[model samples]
Target: MYLDYFPYPSLRLHQDRMLDAVYDTVSSGDHGIIMIDAPTGTGKTSSISAALAARPGKIVVAVRTVSQIDIYIDEISRIWSKTRHKPEIAYMVGKQKICPLEREFRGESVYAGCARLREWSRNYVSSRIAKGSSSIYDPASDSMPEEEPGYRTFCPHYLKSREGFELNGAVHFRRSGRALDVVESLKKRPISPSQLAESCQGICPYEIMSLYAKDADIVIMNYSHLFSPDFQDIIFQWLEMDSEKVTLIIDEAHNLGDAVRDMNSRILSMRMIDLAETEVEKFEGTLGQARLDESRERASWRREGIRIIRLLLPRLKKFLESKQQRMAEGEALLDADLFRSFIYADLDDIEEALSNFSDVAVAVADLNLAEGDRENLQGEIQPSLALVLLFLNDIERAEKDDSYQSKIAVSGSGGKRQARLEVNNIDPAANIRRITDNINATIMLSGTFSPLEAYELYLLGVENRAKKLSLPNPFPRENRLILGTRKATTQLEVREDADNREEISGHIRSLIE
Candidate 1:
């Protein structure tokens, strides 16, 4: 059915199977999870795109990295070109990656500096709109540049796009009096990030791309776009769209568990504590803080910061001094059962301590929000504090879920190190449900998503309504050589042993020869 729209010369057996799965899922109008295993060399990308092109509603291909976005943009361009009906396509990336205003601050941290600039831009635009100035973009305004002959001069989507993309056809540019369709040109030949950044001279590329994605036929984005809450407000909402139809393709899904964990994992360190203390000391002595009365809400947070520094910190410091080993030598795990034996007794007290430290982290972070220090927050303090808070919150939340296991570890020099807590969601399947639950059709694709049992149970949350599909190698294997030899073990401990290492090295040498 998709032959004309499918751009590939010929589909391999596995590729055809993938295409069928995607088409069938869409055809059945199913609303459940699908674990799709498509190994390399199967032309999986083309098959999936061609299949999805025929599906109704928006398609959000959530990939792992910016580089993956590049691949899809190219592939989507190739496959979509085959179809008589072209779908609007866009890629979503972080402002740090796409921000246009960040160019001026080349040497400094662009993301950190752009925060204020973005805020300023929003205010600038809003204020102009309020004053009814001509600078304010008016989509309905018939005022437009010269129209190109072939391109649609007036696409409804162009109105929402402030960058003059909503034109009689895609926004046209004149090169020596000849009108050129920018959007059509883009579909014909996709540009790299640098080129796109250059083309987006004035308008915020992030906003422009997001506007395009909000109405696009396909939106390719990073994993964080779905998993990170911050992106929900900015990017994911545009991608995780709903209609009578929806399909979410998690590419490179072999690392789904890791990606989820990375999204959920939080860590705190002694460095944060040190920074908190130093910031508190400096903040308390600052003239601005001194002028503020005790009635100020910030003063209370400042007191909490001081309390963490004066009281909570000493306990950690003492414990570090007591322990002979910390993260430097490796790590020492604190037993869960011994929770009471630690300095903090009841769970309430632990929560309170963690909460206080979290407050201190907040105070320190807010203190850095000062004009001079805002940019450094991203480059320095915020990361450590963010991890620390994530760690604490993870422990707190895991306490409520039996599926989670929490262990505390101590790292760094005893002189002034904080404890590191690691919380592993033993069953991330349950947590992953929250992310995939709403989608009508969820496609989890990976090269190594085998042992379908584990994947269905652990990755897909093993829903009764879910469909697990595994495709066979499409290519003939008669000419392929599958070689294996058991010689020396490469297990961690054994591999470190001198005799085992020598034996493994010998086997490697023999294999190479």
Candidate 2:
């Protein structure tokens, strides 16, 4: 994994050492994560990236968010300028950030929109051709105009993927000829979400980049992609990446633990139940007896699901509302049978009913149908169903697994004392292992790994399977300075106090001055 074709003329003293450490460990044919900690600006990106690039397989760069994209873009561009091996690079974000059909786009409705676009973009040109042949234009006798459809004229990004560039009178990516003609067209694919939105109209960023990632040498994405089961399935099943051979380069390594926790963390609230109950009431009130009788069975699952939840609520609320004082601690467990039954008997039906309800909700919102029944289906029902489903799934797991601890924490009471039931994986190691089990190796780099032992034991589950490297700060004596201050009480309560806040503000001003 040593860098044979790095663009940089020289690496910093610490960077050089890190580069070698990475190369040695990876080249040793190790099978586990390699953790490295160095102060910021140690050239960690260049060193690790160059090392990974030197190897044969694709480099998967995972960051915490889209805001930090330039790190990879700048590093790769700088490196690519100097190497003949211009690795195909691609990045992806959730559909709300990339899709155009939704109100705010992004992947807000990705589960619905993405499926539509993938099928739409593929058949767009054929649909156009078939439409044109029978109407305004002749198919067999006349050559079709460059854009027979008006949408293609205004939406070039849509057309680029729909109708592949014709090189030598044949479609480029369709039949595989000279890729030269469509190189510029392919470059239009955005590297980030903002760029994607500004790229063009009618273009699905997630769909386009997914295609690019399928053949890419390095696929850059948020750390979230790995944390989500849906995205994990997409990685192996949709993107067709060979999980056993693909290497993982997880940046902001310290945050992975928290990210995993946040990803797995779920809360099903009383407010959701209230909203769901309101929606059901609205459906019944608006539809009336005649219409309700006609379509009641269609949404029978929804009412049954809600009824089951109603049965469990009072019992759950009482248990959660019990004597407890920990701010956000997992204090105790509840009856998992209630959650498990919901999962097995009602979860799937609830999901389908929620989806069916959403279409009706949208119809009501748009005033396309049932104008009198404007509130027939409330928008909150689907999300409520989703949260409830996730909550029940966690509960089901808690019943079966010893590692997971289920708790009911305070979510603020309204009428009859509200609570939030949650299942937290006490040790994230097992879950983290499942994430990387298919991968060949994982490399994690962070500016600080202060509590390395805890991270290894709790987060990675790789205390024995991973290698570690901790280097001293390399800044020179004059370049860095450490300052000390005493008599400052910035504890939580003190910060909340006005007098303490003023004192802290004065100290900060003095320090700055």
State which candidate has the highest TM-score.
Answer: 1
Candidate 1 colliding pairs, count: 14
Candidate 1: deviation at residue 167, Å? Answer: 29
Worst window of 10 by summed lDDT in candidate 1: 171-180
Name the Cα RMSD for model 1.
10.2
lDDT string for model 1 (405-457, tens) is 76666545647554655677666665566667765567778877887677777
Give the count of colliding residue pairs in each prediction.
Answer: 14, 8
TM-score of 2: 0.65
Q: Tell me model 2's lDDT, rounded to 2 decimals.
A: 0.56
- Residue 68, candidate 2: alpha-carbon lDDT: 61
RMSD of 2: 9.3
